[model samples]
Target: MTSVSIPRRMKGVQIKNFGDAEVLQYKTDLPVGVPGHGEVLVKNEFIGINYVDVYWRRGMMGIPPNGIIGREAEGTVVSTGAGDVNSLKVGDRVVWLAMGGYAEYTIVPASLAYPVPADIKPGVAAAALLQGLFAMSLSHKIVQVKEGNWALVHAAAGGVGLWLCQLLKALGAKTIGTASTAEKMKLAVENGADYVINYEEEKDLVKTIEEVTGGYGVDVVYDGIGKDQTQNNVNVVAKHGTIVTYGAASGFPAPISHATLTAKNIRFVGPAESALMRNIGGGFEKWCAKLFDTIANDKINVVIHDTYSLSEIVRAHKDLEARKTTGKVLAKP
Candidate 1:
């Protein structure tokens, strides 16, 4: 431990009751928690706002009531509890993914805490972990992206959508991104998308994709936006192509059909976050090392759309649900 002044009380957003983002109650008088053995208390510099936070707050996920709602943050370790926690020490700049991140100070298991590169900005570091890994897994692990493959990324200006576009480009693949607004379409193009589809102005999404590919169709479709788009995704993919329905932002997708998958030879699977965590958790240190290298080399860009104070979390969530943000939304306390 160093000579940093530790606070006994902190501010944070807690789920008063699960429903909408309105349920998030920002409390200034919450007690700052002490780190247990092998845990480190982080003075959060920036907390990443993700849709999963919405799921937790909406009763769609299993998080308990009064749970502080967030999964990732970048901060400096202000104190450490007694245990062997590898190379971590007080004052080290690190990124950590753990719940209770919607706060001024968060306690994270030491092993899950990763050191941030000195050159990486705090916002970028805060943006990198879960969303970045999800993008990486889709490219490198879930489906090995090959050179010259054609891909479709829905919600292209969204956090993971931009990452998917950039990483696909790095792998020598082409991406056609679908976005609702012209601003979002331009953002997708800026982030390495080969083509941008303004789905708002377009009527048939499947037709647009087919026309872009000269009727050849895309090799992969990343459908993070669900609802009716799920069925339309099945129609748009090429023969032997793959579809990763990683999320359902619009709502839960229509039930998939085995007959359709068998008929098209399309491999339809969802991004298994928990399974990925189990398999890659042990190798995360190495993955993060490579991620930093890629970032340093400017292989991809990490965009910070907006910043909000912890007290304005309700506003942040409102803006997020309204689709007014692009790339990553960050909050600092």
Candidate 2:
């Protein structure tokens, strides 16, 4: 395996106990991890900040004890571990979907790492990789969206939300997006939402979406804002339509009776993107390729809401949780 001059210590954020953003402890003396079998030691250049990270930090999601608090990052491989690494070698610029990303260095399994093309900037790759693949899985795998299909996307200005807008647009779907503010609504529209609703102002959101679709209701709803919007999703879905609830920004959606779905023949699924990716053969590589290709061809745009230094992670989480961000947020170590 190839190796380089590695450091004994690096900077990272560790969560000893789950609670809130303050639980994330930034330290300069954290040990740099070594790559194990089929793993690569990566020097992270840019780390992606996702809402899911907040869940992990707050104990809403299960993580290993004393775990680091990030899921994805883009970096350069400084060392390779034992065994075949899927043709990856030291010095390869790659993006990975894995745990422990809120660090200057990470041990990434080669299977989760994809080489970044020369034209794609590290920050762009970092910003788009996870969310782009997630959006694809939601629109294509979770439910096969067809041309002219109507999709309702909640938090349409968010990381995954914006990507959903672009992907659904590329598929010729009519998208109705809900955002909290005028600026967010504009961003959603620019990303390809056919209709945007300021949910904060629109007292009757269900009625507004129904009107946009001419009383037919949306064919599918991508709901990231759970709990508060859960019942509303059931109310606005068309007959036989699907609702993919992937995140719980507003808290996990309340459980529903099976009969509620049966009443409209609606399908409710809430698969995490990691599970969805693993279920399909070569899913990681396939979606990563699709994401990079689309970006290369100008088929999609990567919006960066902000970039924070690793030390500023707490403020970053606060911004995200407060709905102060419109697109992907990145952190540089």
Candidate 3:
């Protein structure tokens, strides 16, 4: 591969102030710095738009003033810093979950970069890297789901939820997924969900869960929709089962009753990427490599709902926030 001089300036979508999607604006002359020690500069080709980005845009999760937005992207290494970061080199195609992947060029620590599999498309890598690893970490490390156990995945049609359903099935667990629409329900079923509930129509989510489990409650509930689904998740868990609350997409906070938890013997687990990384010692990149292998071997299927150009990022965010998108959304640079 031929090495090219890193550009002095790059384009990025900057959010100067917290507001709606319209607040995001294109900045074409942003400084493009060289990779420092133990860092690599990536020339991004595709970036993922997740629900978390929406939170940042809406100021639900405060960002440092003048912070660059976005978390996951796929690109090629344009330059590398000094030290023992030998795995990556200029021209290498890679994917990483970094702080500011919305830009055309961004610097990431060597630890965060992982090689993209030959079989995976750049857009697929961007779409799946962060969410796939999150799902894998939750299922294998956090919940430790075993064979034949039943798991309930909330927001099963969303990016991470869809991946969770597939990963749970691969681990030999029966998955019951919940989506908001019929189209999403169908997608979940096609993606390995044994049972799917359209929460919009099925007001009694707990009853539907019981019916799917043959009167026995699920062994684990991956609640990403938060508030609306959290309590019901706790209620539907079998004795000694675990309830993992990973996301809050329902615009409300999940309420927990201490008395109810004590009576049910249910274990409540919160899987945060930062916390998991701290506990595991090696951080998320190690888990990301394992998931990339799964994707390469066809052990898991990543669902990408749509792709848009970088200029259309606001529209992309609008669709995602509106729940109009079923799976992952990608923005290509």
Candidate 4:
């Protein structure tokens, strides 16, 4: 276990009010705290910007009234606190999904740190951690996709959706993905989508899905777009098929009518981050380690579209909210 001197102060991005990207402020020379018990101090190289970060920035998800926002980053461990965390030490190159990752330095629980492979860049690792882990966990553990089964992923060319396509393919399930543009549709197909639906072009999403599945419909639909796709899910899911609603990117809650499910004998599962965090007793850290292993072995590939400096975070947020960028967007401090 090598030791390194930790920085006393660092630069960071802070959100003082919930509103637009204008609220994000750059603070230089903020005090950097040492790792407490069972913690490791990370010198961040790159941080992943997610749509949820935008939601947090806008007060949509009920974050603290004024909070530091970010969920994933990759960096090197500079120090460790007093504890008995196994297989982790200073100088380890690691990626994690702990909150407060937008800073130049962050204190992460040793349990949450997982080493990045030599072949994987810090930017790529940062982009992969949260979305890849979520997709892998949902497809493998939550939905339990089986061989020859059909799975539908909404926003399939976006961060988590692209990863879900790969994971479902690896699990032997046939994948169908929905995107808004032709470029995104092509990207989804390149990423292992057996069928790609351009929802903007195809108003009849259910009909296209049914035709692709030979009128039997799919076994599962990973509905990340929420409200916009919820009603159509019933028309596309086979009898006894499961519909997992994980995100609400459509900016509204999905409307559900009891008769729809009752008539089709369908089951709906909600895979919220809180529920997933509860299901994995060892917590997100352990789950991230498993995700890292999969990436190292080429079982999953993380897609990153662009990287911006901390000063350019506002522009990054705008691009993300406008849906102009595909795959993961990242920030380097």
TM-score of every candidate: 0.96, 0.98, 0.94, 0.92
Which has the better lDDT: candidate 1, or candidate 3?
1
lDDT of 2: 0.91
The models' CA-based lDDT, in order, is 0.86, 0.91, 0.84, 0.83
Q: Which candidate, 3 or 4, has the higher lDDT? A: 3
Clashing pairs in 1: none
Two-way TM-score contest, 1 vs 3, winner: 1
The per-prediction tally of clashing pairs is 0, 0, 0, 0
Candidate 4: clashing residue pairs, number: 0
Model 4: per-residue lDDT, tens digit, 1-333? Answer: 676776687888888889998898888877787889988888999998998888888888777422678887899888888876446778889887677877898887776778887877558889887788778778877778999999999999999899999988888899999998999999999889999989988978898888888899999999877788888887889998899988777866466678878888988888766457547646776776677788888877678899999878889998887878888999999
Among all windows of ten consecutive residues in candidate 2, which has the lowest summed lDDT?
Answer: 274-283
lDDT of 2 by residue, 187-214 (tens): 9999999999988889999988878888
- Residue 320 lDDT, candidate 2, scale 0-100: 98
Across residues 1-333, which tens digit of lDDT does each residue of candidate 3 receive? 567877798888888888888988878888898788999999999998888887787787778334678887999999899886657889999887767877899888878788888888768899887788788888988889999999999889999988998988888999999888899999998888999988889978888888879899999999877788766887799998999987778855466777878897888887776556545636666676677788888887788898888888888988988899987999886
In model 2, where do residues sit more than 4 Å from their true spots? 1-3
- Better model by lDDT: candidate 1 vs candidate 2: 2
Tell me the spans in candidate 1 whose CA falls farther than 4 Å from its real position: 64-66
